[model samples]
Target: MQVSYIVALLALLAVTATAQPFLPGTGFLPLGNLRTTDNGGPYNISLLTVQANEIKGGLAAKQNFTDKDIVHFLTNVECLEGLFDTWGTFGHGFNNNLTLGGPTPIGARKANLSDAVRPFMEEVALNEQGHALFTRQAGSDLPCPPIDFTGGFNKYFGAAYNLTGNDTIESKFGAPFDPFLNDECYLLSVLSLEELGATGNKGLTALLTNPVIANGVAGLATSATAQATVQRMLLWERRNNTVYPFNETVQQVFARISALRDSLDGPQMDDQGLVNTDPRTIAVPDYYVNMIPTDVRGLTFSRTPQQLINILTLGSPDGVGVFFPKGLYGAINKPTGFNVSASGLDSFPSSGAKVASQLSTQQIGTLPGPMLPPNVTGELDLTQSLTGTLDNGTAATRGYTIIPPGMPYFSNASQVAVAYPLQTGSSNASSNGSYAYGGRRFF
Candidate 1:
């Protein structure tokens, strides 16, 4: 009887080992025998089975724009390409000099860059190259227009500082304000381009019709914002450091450059510097670390294509200016006298005080820029430096304590990880190219 029972148990185990689970539509075969072909196999879900009417319907779903709208979009793309290409050229020149010993001397003058700063410069140059390539791929067919990096800086810097002659830097400060001359100058030049790229792409986002194209532009804007933020942080760290031959602190130079941009980009206060005396709007104390420049709602500022051209052309009525001697390669290269009215719109309150009264105290703050120190004419002291140690014995960190305006601050990675736990269970294909759950299959 015992021998007969053992034989029956052995037969039951063999049957169980060879058995396969039943699927809803597919008959049972091997344990994991679900397979699919290029034509979607047993499921019969082939693109060839789709009707011509379906294809037409899919194509018709796309939004169509007028010729004028197309031209506007294309022109914005071209402007972005131009900006990226120019910055890439600047970065490439600086990086190439590094290969030949170090940053090449501009005439007899030279600037020193630390190991920490050099890597960031190299990365920014490469990033600009990527940005230009992507912009060209997106529809910017125009070649880079004539750029005046050398004479352009001399001309624009002179206008900004109220200096006379083309050799403004040489006459007023003994050395030219050449970006390639030093790390500070290079960073400042890059900052200007980056800010424009960010604002330009952001302004165009709402006008884009295609989701894929709009997403691409939004990505470019985000990257430009990140690049600008890093550059600003680096400059703010060296706010007290002096620019060569100018006898002005880095912060002072930033203020002047920002002022130049604001002056040329119409009456709108769209530009800002490293520091400001504005009272803190958010819950933090009256700390003045102007790293991320934003509007009252903590939103990034946007610039119309025309306003961007104004700054690029140094407010040239004929369009041609310092950066692009022959003007930008697009229809929107010239400013159209489209200035935002200083008064609030008819639909909104005219007085800023009225607007402030409506909003909570946590949301009130002045505009960025005009970062001149209160009543100080000489170089800014260490007290103004973002990275400088405070007299109260607290260490100044890189980014703000409260980021993105209202979100609670996460002090470290552990806090973030705890707040947003990692999800378990991944979707992966089996060894036989079938899904783990065995419903879908791939060739």
Candidate 2:
């Protein structure tokens, strides 16, 4: 029975996955419906994956070791198994739609395809999953290192690589031009290349031959001034400096997006006005051309080889993990407590540089775009709280590290909401101190 449900759910996902886009090249391939808070509720994967039989069987099956062996579940399935693309960047390079360059209003805000898919895929994006996977596997082994977090405070924009002379990747995001890597822009940009297949070594070459780019391509401007237009778009993106748009729109930007908001969410238009002007499909504007440049002299689209969207999204390279030698901050997934290596640092900088270059590559990368109410965590029903003072007489907080009960990490922005409570009076104060273990980070 449990197996039946899993099979059924997979079928449903497969079916719905084939739904026609409201517009052309509008569905799948680009970001899917995973990330929208409102839209994703009905299709919540948690609800979908839950099977009565499985849960019952998980605990019984793995009586010795299982989150619930009734059904004997495998808690630590490798993220590699979930890899859809050769490079594993959202499994891009397949027959997916190019993120449409238009507003898709859903409720209070207008979202692009990328914005819409975020809520659904957020957890499984592999970026967070990497940490979770590592932590889940961590045990007696010299203790796991903390997550590498680059303290992104969002201030001061348009600066050099590093004021410290090391060209360290300063949060790379700031004000004025919002949607820093936090937005779905990267997803939007990436989905277009989904059909490149598992080993898309020649995917870019195929894209070039599609007739949407330089010399002759769809959505690419056939006009004589097309080259200048592409150049202008590139310059605009550089000026904006937001590769992954995170912040919402400004007055003017909002107005542009506003026109389509009502129509997108409220009514279903038969006409999905996504302009498929990619050089592979048709003549496009300099916007598309410069944004997704295919015309490298003497090079075919397949030769350029579009990197997997995941690579573009989360930064690339399979083995060379990011280096935090100088003690990084709390934003960019900083591998906590790990001794940084120079070779590791040197090797992956190239991949990081590629992602960096790709991000601010075109004007449109600048665009678009959290949470829930929680669950069970209580020490005891009684008034007495679990408190033990340190030998130095310094009282410790109720929960250790404020890392949240189920979670391993603490205080990172994404997980900041899970706060560790402070018991004021004394370690054994009244033997009764109860506070919300992990709620939204208020302070």
Candidate 3:
């Protein structure tokens, strides 16, 4: 009986082994063997290869965007486009005049830009132009707003330093903080703009939904970040060099500018200087250089559209401040009451107090009288034609039409209430603690 049982068990094992080969869904089928029937016909092989347009269309359809969503997306895109346009124009203007034109209002002699730094500045300008082009293609049609590179810089810088008349800037720094005056000034200006651009782009990534559009924005953010990094590296190299006429070093100026920007953009300490000033924070070899501005997690800081507007406007809660005198041409152009001061006029010098008061009373979208010359020219024309080849070897003409004007501007009071519902309280404690540097945490 035992012999019979053993033979039966062996037979069962052999049957199971043989059946395993034919088990359901157990083996891979050859590609040739796989077939599909649709409408009583064989599947078309051409459908296997998906096209770029089809994917984009599918993603857009899936999003099912509403009017509000479209408006928000366009606003963000137009803001970015305007920023690139301004930067590109500034770069071109700088390149056109390599030397400091004349002494500042204070009669301080300016230094010359070295040949070595010219190429880098040119590259930044070209990259900005490319960025503008890409954003234009992506769907921004707002014309370039009036930019006040000369007077704007002076007014903002004066506000930062609390300088009122000719003597303050000239007596102290031997200059009036003119960006086009020297290499140091040019670099400082570039650093300020690029860092803001990088942070703004980083903020936009979270709001974008369409994968294609998000990918394009991601590319822009990456480029802006790289530009900012290059500027910081350059500034770090010149950290110890004395800013002409001033008793302060280049790094000290960097810190002051950073502090000013931080103050303008609400109470957050999102900006950073070239050097690490905190003694409690620990690093190997006492890390003093801060090449990248980041938070506790080593992540780059981001700013909302409102915060960015505040900085551009020199802390003006309303639009029509420095950089963009006429204000941006999109829905996100208006500022919320999240600047250095609730009124946005406290930072202005005595000379600008009247203008600030006038601007404060003006309604949103009301174009202020051109206080400064529209020195920065060149608009993003939609009729501009781009020639390219399609994937299937066919010629294609990629053209864009002007996006219609943004939705009517929101009321200033409504914008303020909606944007910043809760007023942030002041905190004197430093946000940058030793815990950020991987040091011992008291909590």
Candidate 4:
């Protein structure tokens, strides 16, 4: 049958179903006619098919969304592409400069700590690249606009580090601050990026319609959250081993970065361009919810395309910023809500037998100086970070006592293994794909 016929059949079946929440006016957002003709083109159809299968395997999961809502969603995808690209670029630069089994740079690698930082940085780069690719595949019209990673870093870092105008990465750490040099500094910066992505994906996932696409997007968001949590765990571990150079706690630093973003971005707006008086505190529906914990409870913390635009474009109404390009911003309707499968929402799967042990302590050695006191306990309770309860109990949160050995969700092989532990039977080397693990592998 033709694709249109299939879509028509699906629509007909959907309409015939009783009490389905999909509204009467719902339609597919036009993927063509984007703000710019710069998009490479539609993503690989095979990949889409794989994504569709993944979604189906993940189980069936839609909304009164209009063409404008679709536009808003696409626009958000474009912005995410740019943001993740910028972060990936920064991660590469950081990994290279750190001399972590990569190219050399102007300054010395901080404390010769290649092993600790390089792998994590490289993983982050790949994960970010995957995110950007998925965003494009999902339905992005515009190309990733140019972003000044250095300038954006300086702005955020300056706020968090209390650095003066003259003080820069080179001035403070013997290298430019944009890509970062200090190990802790890189950790903190990446931490913030991962957290932003994690939360943003949660909100965006709720807005999706296709179950396959929704599952793919939710996988991206879950990886981001897992990465962020790992960063926090590592930072805490470092702090505990000795009096590290940085004085602030992980929570304090993350809060400072968020505050800087809010202060610079101004008032948050919803999909319909309505002013959000309390953007940080606003609630989102249980669509594509994140199973991991966050600061808020009772409501999923959400950021609409407009809010993302505000922060990424640095409050530019026209989507133009010194660091971000104007074309990156697409018109969005005022903020709205959508419905998704409450039971089948995105969640991090538990660990596997290969590395079932909870993240334990290790001596990371001392830094150059003892700027702060050691945290021998290393027992900073991130339980609060992982717990939130909704008012209506539509969604519940799961907290972890320690970081897992591997990233979670369906975005990766290890994650797939963990997500569908029942599929962990013996296999031949040639049979590499996780067909048992919900058919997540696209190829």
Among the numbered candidates, top TM-score falls to: 1
**Model 4: residues >4 Å from true position, as ranges?**
1-113, 159-176, 239-252, 262-300, 325-329, 332-443
Tell me the tens digit of each residue's lDDT in model 3 across 149-220.
666666666655656656456666765666656677767777877777777666556556667777776676
Report the Cα lDDT for residue 68, model 4. Answer: 39
What is the per-residue lDDT of model 1 for residues 211-263, given as tens digits with 9 covering 90 to 100? 77788778878988998999999998888777776777777777777777766
| Location of the lowest summed lDDT over 10 successive residues in candidate 2 | 69-78
Superposed model 1: Cα runs more than 4 Å off = 1-112, 164-167, 280-287, 340-443
Candidate 4 lDDT over residue span 1-443, tens digit each: 69976775565454334221223442211111001101111111112211222222122212234333443344344343324333443532322111113222222122223577667666666676666556556565444444455666665555545565577545665644533545565675666556556655665565566777768767877787677766666655553231123344443444455554544322221111011111122221222122233222222234434445545554555656534533343344222111111112233122210101111112112212332234422112101111222221111111111123221221211101111112234452125432332222211
Better of 3 and 4 by lDDT: 3
Q: Which run of 10 residues does model 1 get worst, by summed lDDT?
A: 412-421
Residue 388 displacement (Å), model 1:
29
Q: Ranking under lDDT, best-scoring first?
A: 1, 3, 4, 2
Q: What lDDT score is found at residue 270 in candidate 4?
A: 13
Kindly indicate the candidate among 1 and 3 with the higher lDDT: 1
Global CA lDDT computed for model 1: 0.48
Q: Write the per-residue lDDT of candidate 2 for residues 15-68, one digit (tens) a residue.
A: 344432223322212111112112122112222211211122222221222112
